[model samples]
Structures are given as C-alpha cells and as structure tokens.
Target: MPDTRQPVAARRTHCPYCALQCGTRISGTRADAVTVEPADFPVNRGRLCQKGWTAPGLLAAPDRLAAPLVRGRSGRLLTATWDSALQAAAEGLARVRDAHGADALAVFGGGGLTNEKAYLLGKFARLALGTSNIDYNGRFCMSSAAAAGNAAFGLDRGLPFPVTDLSRARTVLLAGANVAETMPPLMQHLHQARLVVVDPRRSATAHRAALHLQPAPGTDLALALGMLHVVITEGRLDTAYIGRRTTGFEALAGRAAGWWPERTEAVTGVPAADLRTAVDLLTQSGDCYVLTGRGVEQHRQGTATAAAFINLALALGLPGTPSGGYGCLTGQGNGQGGREHGQKSDQLPGYRSLSDPADRAHVARVWRVPVGRLPGPGLRAYELLDALGEEQGPRALLVMGSNPVVSAPHAARITARLAALDFLVVADFVPSDTARLADVVLPVTQWAEEEGTMTNLEGRVLRRRALLDPPPPVRSDLHVLHGIAVRLGEPPEHYPTEPRKVFEELAAASEGGRADYSGITYDRLDAGESLFWPCPATPDPHPGTPRLFLDRFAHPDGRARFADVEHDGPAEDTGAAYPVHATTGRVLTHYQSGAQTRRVPELAAVAPEAFVEVHPDTAARSGLADGDLARVVSARGGMTARVRLDPTLRPDTVFVPFHFSGDGRANLFTHPALDPLSGMPEFKVSAVRLEPLPE
Candidate 1:
C-alpha cells in the first residue's frame, strides 16, 4: 500500500475494473505517470486487490489508441483525421442500411461503459441506424441470474442489500463464486461468517470455507436440488413464510420431489453424506445467505440452476432481510446498470421489456417518437455474432468498449465472422484484440478521462469523476455517438455531447418504469449519502431503496413468485473421445479479456500466461505432468496451455482461466449452448481431450 501520510493531492474516483468498483484516489499529470491509493468507500472500505493497485498503468499504456485509423484500399489500417474517420463509419453503416435494410446494421456494447454511453448506444442504434440489433457484453456475464431473478422475484438487482450487510450474516452458502481471488476485499466481511463453498477444485474461496463441497462441473443444479431435498426431508421448511409471502410451493416441492440425496449424489458426483451435511449446516445456520456466481450462471441450464438457489433462499425467508439474501455477484463494473437500460436485445430503459406494448409506448413517448417506429427484439450476443456473415445477418457492425474476440464464446468463429463483415467500427481506449480487426478504430477516452455514472453490484449508482484530460484527438463515447448520429441526418437536439445532459433525458425516460432512477442526479450523488434505485422523480426526494421485497414484490399481486425449476446435465456430455470435463474462470490478477490488465507490466507478471489445472489421476491418465505443455482439444477448437497437477479437484474435471488470447485462450473450447430463457452461453462446462507435447 502507498503511504498516505503526506497531503492529499489527488481526486477521488472509482476503480476502472470489476463490479466491486472499489474506491481510489487518482493522481497524475499525464496519462502514463499516475499514482493510486485506496479510498474510504463503503464497498471495499479502503482496501484494494492487486488489480486495483496496478490499475493506474492502463492510463499510460504505450499501445493505447490515441488517433483514429481507417482501412484504405491497400487493406491496411491508415491514420485518418477525425472528420474522415467519422464520415467513413457513417457512410459504411448507411451503405449497409440502404442495401440490405436497417436490420443489416448492428451495434454491440460493453458492460464497462458508463450508464450514459450504454443508454445512447441503444437509442442511436434505433433512431440513427433504425436497427433492431442492439445488445451488450452483459449477455455473457449475468444474464442467466437476471432472467432467473426476474422470474422468481419479479425484479432483479444484483445484490438487493448493501455489501456492508454481509457483516450481519451468520452463515453463507457461497456457490461457484471465487470472491477470494476475484474480489479480495470482499473477503473481509466473510471472515466472521461460517461459509459453505461448492466448487470442483479447492478454490481459494473454498479453502477458507468451513465446508467445501466438490461437485462435478455443470452439476450445480443437482447439488442445489439435493440440498433442497434434505431440507424437505428434515422438515426444515419455513411453512409460515412460504404460506404468507410466496406462491407455487407445491410445484417447486414436486420438482425437487425425486431429487433425494442418493439420486443427487449419482448425478452430481458429490457424496450423499456431504450433501446432507451442507443441508444441515444451511438449515441450522442463522441469518444465512445463498449467493452464486458465473460457475452456476454460465451453463446451459444456468437459469434453472440460479432459480434453484433463489428457491433455497426464499425457503429460508432471506430476501430483504438484513445481511442475508440471494444475489448473483455481477461480473463487470456496470453489468447491473447495463442490463437495466435498453442496451439488451429485448429490453427498454428502466428494465422494461420490448415485447410489452405498454413499455414500448412509455419509452417511445419519452424519446418523442411514435411507438410503431421502434423495432422488435433482435438476437442475443452469441446468436448475433454467429449471424454476422449469413444472408439475414448484419453486414456492418459497430462496437464500443468491448473486446469480443478475446471474451466471447467460440472465439475462433467470432473472429472469422468479424473478418467477413463488410464494415466494422470499434471505439476503444486501447488497441484490443477485437480492435485490431476493425475497419475503423476510433480512439476513445477511458475511465479517468471521462465523466459518467456507474451502478455497482448493489444497484447503487455512483459517479465516476474525470481526473485528467485526454490527449488531443482522443474523444469520449458520448462525443462519438453524437457525431455519428448527426452525420446520419438525425435531429441534432436528439443527441447530447454532454454526459449530464444525456443523463437528464435518461432519468425522464426511466421515470415511471422499473429500475427507476428519476430522483437521482449528480447533485444527489455528491450529497454524501449512499443511494440505490427505484427513486422516483420528486423534489423532496425519498432515499434510494437499499433493500427489496420488504413488504411486497414488484409484481401486481405483491407476492414473490417461485420458479418450479428442474435439473438437467450439461449440454455436452463426456464420451470416450473426450473424457475430461473442462471448466473456465478468472484468475486473481486479471480481469475479463485482459485488455487493460495485460497492458500493466506488474499485473501481467503476476499472471503471465494461462494454464490448466488437472487432478493427479486425470493427469496420469492423459500423460500430462506438472509444468508440461498440453494441447487441449474440444469439439469446437483447440488451445495449448501449460498443465499443473492438483490433487483436490475432481478426478474427471480440469480448470482453466479465460483471460489470455492466442494459444492460451479458454473461450475457444467453450460451448455456445445458451440457457434458452436468458440467452447466456454455457462457458463453465466443456468436454475435452488433452494431448501432451514432447519436450
């Protein structure tokens, strides 16, 4: 930690990283030379992980894109002036719209983008390009949890209660969330709580827990069902809470009917004794919480699995209670806000659905356009990318703040589809792997160079202050959206170059809808009080909601709905040819895609390359040894990674971190079989065969 005994000379800001959004003080005269110290924010409470400590290096990365580039007739990217670059991008999109209809033009966004940028991207796609193809990277993050939460609780806020509330919990069932490595600072709150973790490998988080249940990959649904079965068999159900505050109990009980401990043990590979012990722990524990992460949310049955966890929490009557609740730890910095806005393929601002006539009329009225002008829902992220080169797929694609080539499932296919596009435009601060493939790459301002708001995992909207100015010709995303819309012959008054101005319009657009932010403003955020959403437009201003489902649910009848979900195995089953189950997750030192973190010399040094963790028996069976290079072959593609032996993991499973590109890329082996309800790709489970390389 940097010494803070000297006088404070930096501006307070939030980390430009994960959904934790830890607070920091940034000091720098130029982009390259900067300093950071932990800020006294409630979320992390003046603590930061290695990623946050070294985040300052991103501002000064030598390869940052400071000037726009356009591909010329020589098939090479050439430096272009701002006017020429914007004109080229607009012309390309316009050409696609004119030739193949508006649906042939598409826009993709990122969850790291500020709330304002995400909002404008959706509106620009609809009003400027007049296309229905608008979705973001969050479909890859927590869409399954969002879908399941909505179906079960009538609404979705990543964590309905504040992070500080975790201190009040006595016991927690942490599933598939390796917060110890992913969000280290959050571990401070868990030290006092009795934790029960479920993972294949002995994860850092699993090691710290009181009880660790090692289930097979893609068997989280079965594990949860087994626990529920124990709760029912032991007569530990909260019949009072269920009878009073929920419905569909009979259906849920019936779904978990056949999933006794023995049956669950057979499917999940977890011992029946361990399942019974976990159930007993959860039942006996007071003020308990059940939380999940991508491990459970990034599978083919992700939605059903998430529903199972929520059902477990509701059966214990944990929602809206202090320190005890169900939440899907959102992956990206603005993922919660990203999904709440209109950037989703089938959503409108304020989390309204595009399929609803009332929601369409409400948003159309706010945008000052006829309701009929708005297009219907388009394809989800994976489906949209898969359609890129097809006849009905988009011909020209505009991307912002995302690096899909390194992050999306089936990376080889996405790269090829991007290569086949007639036009590709990317607005990013760095020359990301995806940016290197663009026809036009526009230099854009990053976190400290731009002013906007971000909603954290708790659904708390916080302001991201600008601490320094960007170099000449480097523009903000708001500037790019406005410039492009104007060149497309859209009304000038419709697009605002200023973030606050755009947020003002956005607040009005969200006034009467769910996920309401009407009462929040820059002024209120600066008022030294923590605030959450559903703050309706008012002068007196009610405090933002930090808790949900206290008295009634968001649904009309004022009762939380229950999902009668059933369990299923993974999309791809292991066979003789591919006998090992491969799973992917993030390492402690890297963020998603590693676009920014990899640029930091220190962070890269900490996690320089990707490697696979294989159990001792599996390693021996495959002839792989510690520190040996292995080529992992899956149904879709293959990647070479170093293998390390782990005795703790399930003998049939292997683990890989999905950070690096090229030979170490993990997404190359992932399956795009989506949870139909949420459109989330199954990134957690894949069947593979390993081949060791000769020394």
Candidate 2:
C-alpha cells in the first residue's frame, strides 16, 4: 500500500551530530519518514551513533518552528510573515544602534553553524552593524586550546592530523579526554595503542586504559611538568629533536626540574610510581600522541595546561609525524572550522590575529570595507554576558544556533541579564530556552535540510548535503542573514543569495593566511574528496589530505615552542560548605543542551531524565539511594535531579551532565570566572555539595 517496491533515493552527507562527522546516507523522501544509514566513508567506515542514526527525526518533530514568530504586545508569541519579522528585527537593532552606538549591540554565534553562516555573521557584526561586541559559544568550548596552540605552534586545528592515524600509534596519552563516552567509535582505533588516561575520576575511557592518573582537579599542569622532569632528568628526552626542531627547551626543562614527581604527587592524587610508568610508556613507544580535552582547557591554568601538553609532545619528537603529535579533541562538529573563519573575537579568517596589519588589510579587502571600519577583537562570551545588565551593557543581541542559557556559565545570572536587553533576536529551527526570551525568533533550516560543509575533529573538510526540502515558511540561515543585511542597506553584491558563493568568498578571505584553505572548493568537496586544511594553493584532486605537517611545522622557525606551566588550583576550590568537586560534561545519549536529541522519542525513551553521578561512598554519606532525587547545591545556585552511584568516580568528586535545564540547569551552579588567556569558563570543575531531596 506504501509503494514498498519503489527504491528510495540515497542522499550522501555527514552526520549533523558530534565532531566525529561520520558519513551518512539519507534514505526515503521528505513526504515519507526518512531513515539515516552509515555510509562507507573513510572517517567512520560504516558506523553511526544513536544520535546520528536518529538525526532525521528532528525534521518531523511537532514542536519545530516552521514559521517566523514575534513576541506580540500581549507578551505571547504569534506567527508572522518573513517580511514583517525581518522588518521588526531590523528596526529594533537600528534603534539600538542609533541610540547607543554599535558597540552597545552584540552578536553571539555557535560552532554548529556552517562556515558560510559563521563568516556572514562575523561580517554582519563588524561591517553591517559596525560593532566590535561579537563573540560565540566557542568561548566556552575551544578558546583556551586555540590560544595555547597559537602561542606555542602558530596554528590550532583540533587534531593537526587525521584521527584514524591513532591506530598506527604505539602510545596514546589522553590527558583529559573521555573518548569512550564522547566519541565511542574512536576507541576502536585506540584499542591497539597503550592507552594512558589522566583525569580526577576514573572515566569509562580511563577504566579501559593501561594506566589511569587521577590528579587533583586543577593540578594537571603539575603532573605534566613532573612527567617532563622525569623525562629530562633520566635522559629520556629526545635530545636531537630538542636541539634541532624546537626552541625554549632550556627554559621549559628548568621549570620542569622544580616539579619533581615526589613534589607533584603531594599536590596531585597520582603516585610517583604511576607517573613513572606513564612516562616510560611515552618514551618506549615507536609512535606516541599527546591529547588534551576540555578537562584540561576549562580552568584558570588552561593555556598553561595546553602548553605543558605540547611541551611533553615536542620533547618526545611527536609533531610532524603521522601518528605522533599533540592533539586537542574539539567538542563541536564545526569547532575546527569555526575558529578558522573569524568566529572568534580576536581572529580573522584563516586563524589570523586581528592585530596583524597584513591580516587586517587582507580581510578588509575581502569584505570591501576600510580597515578602520573593522574594529579589533571583542569581549569573550562570559565577559559579554556579565556586561549585559550593567549601565554600559550591550542593549541588543543576535543569537544564532546556540542555547546559551543552558550552555553558558552562571545560568541564572545570564538569564536575568539577557531578560534586561532592549532587543534580542534568535535564529534557530526550534524555540530553545534562550529563544523563548527573544523579542524576535526566526525559523532556520536544520542540518539534514541544508547544503554546506563542516570540518571534523580531525580537520577533515567534508560536504554536508541536503536530504529534504525545508518546511514551508522556514529558510536557511544564510537566507535570513542575507535578508537582514540587505534590509540594512548593504550592497547587493556584498550579500550573496547562494551558500556556495558565500563559502567561496570565505575561502578567498582565508587564502595566504595562517590556516590556508585556498585549495578547497565546492567542486572538489562535492566530488567526494575529503582533505585536511592548509590544503596547498595548487589543488590535489586525490581525496584532499588525510594528515598534515608530515614534513614541516606551521611556525616561522619551523619548530614548535614548548611553554613552561606551573600548578594552579581551580577558580573555585572545594571547602567545608561545598566539600565535593563537581565536574560537568556530555553523556553519550544527549548532545549539547539536549536540543534535537531530546526530541527523538526512542533516544528520549532510553535516557528520559537527567541525573547526577556520585560515588557510592558519597551517595551513602549523603543518604541518597540510587534513583532517588538529590539536590546539588553550590554557593551560586542549586538543582534537584535523580542520583546514580557510579563506582568509577572518586569519593571526593561528583559528575553532572550539562544537557538538562530549568530546575536542573547544571550551569546555574558553574562558576563564571574564566581562564584569562583563553576566556573559557571553568566548566570542568566547581565547588558544590549534595543532599537528599525531601519528599
């Protein structure tokens, strides 16, 4: 009866979920329920996670906003035509700009957007709106690693090489990444390597590791320096590599000498014997990789921790090798590409700093604007939100593809400040919690219904093709942004209608810059050839690049710099009132903020509610039984959630997944203090206490 004999057309694309960017095939038409199947692409071969497999269900969700909506005078949201919606949004922004200058308005973006959208948003913020108060959700995700990598190596791609290369490695040191829960398929490759996982808790990945180094929450730098001390003092350092391929070795080694294992053990919970074993594994491996994640990057010493990781890698001659290097495991699908395309406040396209005159001139020319019009880097996310309710606060904001109320630090404060804004606009497929506060909400197309490109965790640029037509009245993000720019009197040539043309302009802006992408084109990507970035000016038609820096470094001296890092505690330390150290992270079942995944019935059925993970001892002490509601309280806020006693967690620590909101908003309790250099909030560690919720 349903035409079962008809062959469904196959639409090839990348998963819209995590940074894994596994290939997927959309089977069936928009009229019928579509099914997502794993494609046999090089990245994941044929593996699909629960999120990826059910990604298409989001398209048909009943709650999806199919038409633009405006908050009427009655304080109720009602459907409005596109023209009316755009006009209202433009007038509000223009009024704010006229009254308080452009700096009084702000724009926030996210890593989930395509490169075209990211570039246009940055362009609109700087050129159309004439504002320097532009930032993004990346301020919470990758700014720290980006800052450290730029300081040390002049580049910051998540993996500077392909993730599959890890299979060839003999030793893989996972400094703070929980690969088993975040990207489970990656464990298949890590299985062969001598795994070394470092974290305060014995995470799932750490439990499977050859060695687990449980350090105090903020003492990762100390343990890293201590390991480096052993390597240098015991003559295990690769002297030839140090002499020929790196600078600042003496300074780094001198800093390490003061961090002896015995001293480090006193600060960190890890013992000296375990530290020796971890270093020995690194020294003996034919090929080794040093990896860091948000655990190491979301702290006061974030940049220092990243630098220490790079120092250890350079000391071992890891960079520029196929399976050997220092990798920062990025969290978002477009985290790698987002930073390269000027989404960051301090950067331009191609990861060029705005302070550089040549970089400034290059971008100014690309955007056809005077260099003077392009203001310098703006405030980071946390700082921007903190400025929201002040007398000199940003009065208007444009939020694209992010739900910061749940994701940003200090949830209650951010929500209160955002409510005070004179105007707020949000462009998204769904009316997220943050969107609910918006004066204007624009309906944008979802990933499976849009055509663009995304760079994965490994820096592999791949095509994301549209499988279904957008619902009537909904439009692509590019279309919405372009309309707004045109309405604001931007030249027609400056605002292109097609996404491909915009991407080409973005690529041209990046040409000859640090993160060179001159070689990438829509034509090549459509031909099913994936390539790592810094793809040369001359095109290589054969599947782009699988690895980078095989022969050279991006630094001017052709060597990576090693930075000296010391021990520093978290922004908020555990104390008598808040004795437990609570960390926030993602669960395999839910993606960031539980936006689209939570809408899927099957996925929601499996993981229907949020829960706090506590050690059995902690549960017993707090009188919290398994599945009982427990109140997690901090100095700033508190929330009630079901409790699960996890054996893997340490007795002194607890874990909370940052996907739920409202009464269970984990970010409400997260400290707002940020790493000065990276601007990343301390999401991984905070001070809190737990109690059994009374019936």
Candidate 3:
C-alpha cells in the first residue's frame, strides 16, 4: 500500500497568469487533484487572485496539447514525436533562409516568457537565424510609453520605483490606468494617496478616486497641458528644480501658455474648474505621482501624450524624488524586462539603440560574433506582419509564448498573412489561437515548472522558482530554443547549454548600456535578493538599483527634456456608421487573452462569457437590454457578445475586456494605425456600431 502519511501526490507550483506574477504553492499530482495556495512572497504577501488559486487546474485540463502537433496534408493537426517536430521546424527554417535570405523569416516573442527564454529567443533569432525581422507582443503593450520615457527622461523602467512607495505619496494622478481591475492588489497602495483618475469613462479606478475627470478619448494631452497651464499660472511650478534639474523649460512653458484651462476645457470636455482643482491638489501635495497606462499609450499620439504627462511631472519636479514621479504602468508580467533585453525592433540588450556603435561593439563581443553579424534593429510588429504579404515578404515565422491571432491588430489581415507563410512554428504550453495555425507546435513547460526571473511594473526583478517537475515529454522553453539554435549552426560561444550561463551572457551584453545589468548574476538572484536594473558596478556591496535618477539624470547634461506636446484626436472617431467609441482592456477575473486563466474552471466560472459594456441610455437607444446579444461592428471587423449596460460608461462609449477568443477577439475591432514614433497600435479607441442581434 502507498504510504498514507506521505502527501497524496506530487507538489505543484505557481500560477503563470499576469504581471502580478503571484507566487502559488502547489501540492498534488495528476493521479489526484492539485491544490494551489499563495506563497508568502514580499510582492503579494500571500495574496492570491482567483486566477492564481485556480491555476493548477489548467495543468490537467482536457484540451491541453500534451505532445507535439504538426499540420498534415488535410490541413488538420496530427500528433508527432518531439524529434520529428524539431527536425521539421529546423528544415523549414533552413529552407526559408537558403531560398529567401535571413530577412525572409520573422520571429515573434511574448512578454510572458522567462527572462532566460526571452534572452535565448533573441539570440536564436539574430545569431542562429541571422534575421532582423523580429519583434514581440510587447510592441503593442508598452513600446509607446518606453519611446516617450526614453526621449524625455533618457530611461524607461515602468514605475522606476517600487509599488510599495506609492503608499508614501501624498497624491497620485492615475491617468488612463485601470489598476483596480487589472491589478487589484495594487489598489491597496492607492488608498493611501489622494487618488485622481483621468479617463473618458468613470472606470472602477475612477469611481474610487477623489476626483475623476472624464475627458474624451485621445484628449488626454489637452488635459495634461491644461493642468500644466494652471500649475504654472498659479506659480505652483517647481521653478528651482526646473532651473537646475531639467532643460527645455522655456519651450515647454511657451507651449503651455496657449493651453489655458478654458481653452483646454473646450477641447477635452473636462471642466476648467476641475482642472484648476487638480493642479492645486497636485502642487499642494508634498509628494505627487503621475501614472499612465494602455489607455493613453495605445494610440497614434501615445508618445506625445506620455511626453506631455512627463512634462507635467517635470514642471512640478516630481521625478527623481521620493514617492513622486512620472511612471508608465506596464501591463505584461515581463513587459519591463522584455523591452530592456533587446526584444524590440530598434534596440539591443541593456536598452541600447542598435545604431549606437559602442553598444553594437559591446553586444557583439558578448555574443563572440563579428560586429557585422548583428543586424541593425528591424521592423516593428505590424510592419513585420504587413511585410509577410509583400513581394519581399517573410517566408517563415517562429512564434513563442504569444497569441497574435487574438492579440494582434487587424486580426483578419494578420491571420491571412500568417497563413501565407511557407512555414510557421510555435512553441508554447498550450495550443493557443496562433499555435492552432502553425505548421508545427512544440510543447513547452509552463511557469510553475520553470525557473527564471520577471521584472514587475516597479522595475523590481524577482525570482520565479520552479516547484514541480514538468509533465513527461515537455521541456523548458529555453532548452527548446537553445536546441534549435544549435541545430541551426549558431557559433559555439552562443550555444550555451545552461540557462544561467545564457543569462550571465545577457547581463554582459547589457554592460555600460542604458538598461545595464552587468553587476548582477544568477548567484545573487538565487540568494533571494532582488533589485531593479541599471545595476552597474558599485564600490559598496549592494547588488542592484532599486530607484533610478535619485541625484542625477541619465542624460549627458543631467537634465530631463520636457516635451512640448499638442493634443491629437484618435485614429478613428465615433460617427454615424460606427457610433460608439469601443475600448478594450483587462478584467479582474482574467488576464490577457485568457490562455491560462480560461483553463481554470473556477476562474472561467467567474467570467464565463464575454460581454460588451454600454451605458444604459445607449443600450436603451439601441433596443438592447442587459444580457441581450449585441452585434458590435467597427470599420475593421465585427463581433457579437452579451450586452451589459454600465452606468459608469459614457453614452457614446463601449468597453470590452480582451480575454475571449473566436468571434470575441476584441483586437479584431481595434484599429491598426500606429504611433509614428513607437509603432504601437491604437487599441483603446476604435469607432464601432452597436446593435441588438436578431432574435
């Protein structure tokens, strides 16, 4: 008889849900039901969301792809052996490279990957495949904010400080972020600050705020400019700090001169009085913080909006101060780290620009390849996909850890272009919407069965420990990527077998660059110590930086540049055919696309169906009631979902959470127009028509 005293089954591990990256302790095995409990980590302090607690159920879900799958002659997926799958992938990639050159293949990565896996994927794409047409889902998530921050402050680390620091702030201006729903635990800190939420609708975060300014979508820049105008006119600006620590004050002040409250009020729909009050509160507070999220960054004017927001922070001397600054609230779990490690179209590891000769030389030395072997930055995501259908299109693609069919913009066009590829390979734990379209799908270990690090919104790099063994026939993503690189004849120096060694090499590649991580190692991380990046060599014994730009800015002049920005409308405006401004976002019950959370029965039960949120007045006008099926159509695409009249939403606006699949792909209706500077698609505001579905 089996020992009854022993645990009934094998131990489980943490959930691979959101950027919250909550620690979960799993105990049980496939023979029995698995149990998951929150671990007492400093980040969450044993707090677990419904998604985290129910994550283990997904491991044994019936629909999980337990083995390799490959498309057959009939265009349907068939089970295949690991060797056969890998060989096919290698041959297909090699054929594409030989026939069409390296640029003919594109690789798409995800923000959910382990740092080791992310690093190796970039290495494989550039070194092994010799392709520059590489980008990631992060291109949609945080690239615009990063571009804005890099241009204005010379650095972008999301929050640039810990989330815990928010509790120390006297006032917090949450512009466009919906933290209460996307990251509920973070709301605990917001309660301490006098919260001010700015959005087109009274979102949950806005309802909780002391002041909620409901401006029209895409008019955030005007609201920010107006606030700056009030602050400056009232002599509330931090003149001493601006005189010493910042540049471009004269140009910025001149730009704000024309954006008086009355003028901005007419443009943004925010009351002039409210704008003045917001400015007064911001200036009176000892410590104030300004934060922006996807609502502001996923737009054509994203970079400019971010710059304008930063200008307000700079005008008040908030940045580089304790518990006060301008922060971009990144969405993905590894969104901060993913961009920092050269996953973007125009960057190298260490957040270095590909055009920088010294950065190129340093990374080339680390990879042990000639500087010429590393191509300059490639096209962004939308451009990469668009190139797939062009005469000089990519013949093959290797996608890892992302579901672009559901997540990417212009879904119909992107799907058609993907189908045109000569070869497609996807490496993931489950059969995602994108994987289902691949020529070959390789099974990989999930978060609970993997070991690595993930940097959170606050730039805090924390360890993600593997607590259980992966299922049979499954391997780590890093291992799978390394094997592919080796099979493709990458240089021996770049063919490191160990994940830790690869991370060390990645750290070395980041040395003396903007997102510097040279001073860190796997050893230090394994010791339960964590810190932010730019951890350069120091004389003391500390490991990494927790807060950046405390005494000096990263710019050569040690001064932050204030961007003079003007308001711009969204790409698509609400009109007769498309009468509602459709917005997409996350929900408390689910994470992006619901690839993991949907597997959990409990989490699925909590949010079983997709629904479009419309105001009661609009729903009535459209002859629809709550729970009624509503057909929503935009210029790009259309979908049908159950309707829920939200009192908080403005009459002309609709909201949809981007967690469902099939016809419920919210991105299907999103506009593909991108920010000129960052190439981030505008997912927040799309013109859409809502009508009651036929009975």
- Listed in order, each prediction's TM-score against the native is 0.98, 0.97, 0.96
- Comparison by TM-score, 2 against 3, better one: 2
CA lDDT of each candidate? 0.88, 0.84, 0.82
lDDT of 3 at 618: 91
Q: Give one clash count per candidate, in the order shown.
A: 1, 1, 2
Higher-TM-score candidate of 1 and 3: 1
lDDT of 2: 0.84
- What is candidate 2's lDDT per residue for 349-458, written digit by digit as tens? 88778888999999999998889989988888889988874689799999998999899888999999899999999998888999999999999988877888888888
* Model 3 lDDT, residue 657, Cα: 85
- Candidate 2 clashing pairs, residues 3+ apart or interchain: 531-545
Regions of candidate 1 where Cα sits further than 4 Å from its true position: 1-8
Residue-wise lDDT of candidate 3 within 1-695, one digit each (tens)? 11123344433233566666665667665555567777776556677766676677777767777888888899998999887888788888999999989998889998988677777788788888989988999988888889889888788889877777887888999988888878776777777788889988777888898899888777888889999999888999889999989998898888889999999989888899999889877878687999999888888888898888999999999999874988998888888888888777778888888888988898888887899999878889888986774678888999998988888887878888888889999998888888988999999987666777777777776677664567777877776776777678765556665667877887788888887777777777766567678787566745677788889887888889988788878987887788888888888888887887887787888888788999999999889999999877898888778898788887878988888888888888889999999998988889998878864
Sliding window of 10 residues with minimal summed lDDT for model 3? 1-10
lDDT of 2 at 629: 92
- Candidate 1 lDDT by residue in tens digits, 486-562: 99999888989898988888888888888999898888887766789988887688799998878887778877777
Give the candidate number with the greatest TM-score. 1
